[model samples]
Target: MNNTDHTTATVEPAIRLESVTKQYVGAETVTALADVDLPVYGGEFLAIVGPSGSGKSTMLNLLGLLDGPTEGVVRLGGRDVTDLSETELTDARREYIGFVFQDFHLLPTLTAVENVTLPTAFTDGQYADRAVDLLGRVGLGDRLDHTPDELSGGQKQRVAIARALINRPEILLADEPTGNLDRETGVTILEEVRRICERGVAVVAVTHDELVTEYADRTVRLVDGRLGEGDDGFAT
Candidate 1:
């Protein structure tokens, strides 16, 4: 069995945000995220639930190292990376993090397999072989040659999910991953995410879908850029 197939209790958190806050400065300085503390562990599916303008995107950006916090520390594999340079942060993102966005960002011109292998372009095709395996794992074995335009909504999302795992990242950050799918399709995609979490990849999903929260190992609500109440029990 692969190392990612089982969750190990001894593993440290994949990412941790301690008293993290994000502020945008312009005509008026605005705080996007307040002092938020979140720790994401391997094999965990954590849903960050909130309405629009409630800081979900801000938190996802901070967790994915796409943006630095105004204050506090962001740690990846327990190492403080809050002050890393842009180049260092870029390298860290490529090595340690995977991302899936709301829109199936598959290249319209690329085949499913090609889209899955896109991440390899940055690493000299080191993980190119895994593309086929990932596509099969996501139940798209027969759609390998299909382009995004030829696939169903769920199938296209499956391609995106497989692409996210091509790097074998320690953490997967999904922002409104199911926003474009129907209810049934969304459920199918969320189930795939649950399976990935079971395989020991920490999954942090920013979403407004209550149904998505039901699949999470734990759910934390955000309101007015701060952590709110409504602690759903962790997955057993």
Candidate 2:
């Protein structure tokens, strides 16, 4: 097996957040996440559930390392990441994390395969080939030449999922990934995500739909910027 495979095998939790807080300075000010602590183990599927303005998206952004915490620390594979320099953090994000958004975020002009292999821009040789294999696995082999506009919503989302898998990320952070799909399409996407988790990639998703929760092995609820207990959608 490759060294990357070996490394992932040895890791404990893929992601861990300790007393994380995020604040926004819009209009006046707002606290999005308040001292939230979470741990996501490798090879597990986790769901973050809440209503609008419940800090679900904020937590996903934090997990993706797209935004830094206003307080506390975030650790990936047991290493603290909050204090890294911007460049270091950027490198870490590229090497360790993958993201899928509700919008599918594909370039309008790029072919589906090109979109899936976009990570090659930051990575090198072998990973580029790996991206191609990922696209095939997502059942997009015949749609490789099609652009986002030419594909159906489900197809586009499949390409996005393959793109997220290109980096071989230990943790997959998806934010409302099925929000734009119809019920049947949403279930298809969730099943694909569940397949990824079954292959040992940790999948962390933030979703409000109750149907989606059935795919998660564990569900953590957030409310008013705080972590809550059980399924009532309130953070303690």
TM-score for model 1?
0.91
TM values, all candidates? 0.91, 0.90
Give the Cα lDDT of each candidate. Answer: 0.88, 0.84
lDDT of 2 by residue, 81-157 (tens): 88888899888888878899889999998988788888777556776567668778888888888999999898899
lDDT of 1 by residue, 97-161 (tens): 99999997999999999999897775666565688889988889888899999999889989999
Per-residue lDDT value at 118 in model 2? 86
Best by lDDT: 1
Q: Predict model 1's lDDT versus the native.
A: 0.88
lDDT of 1 at 10: 55
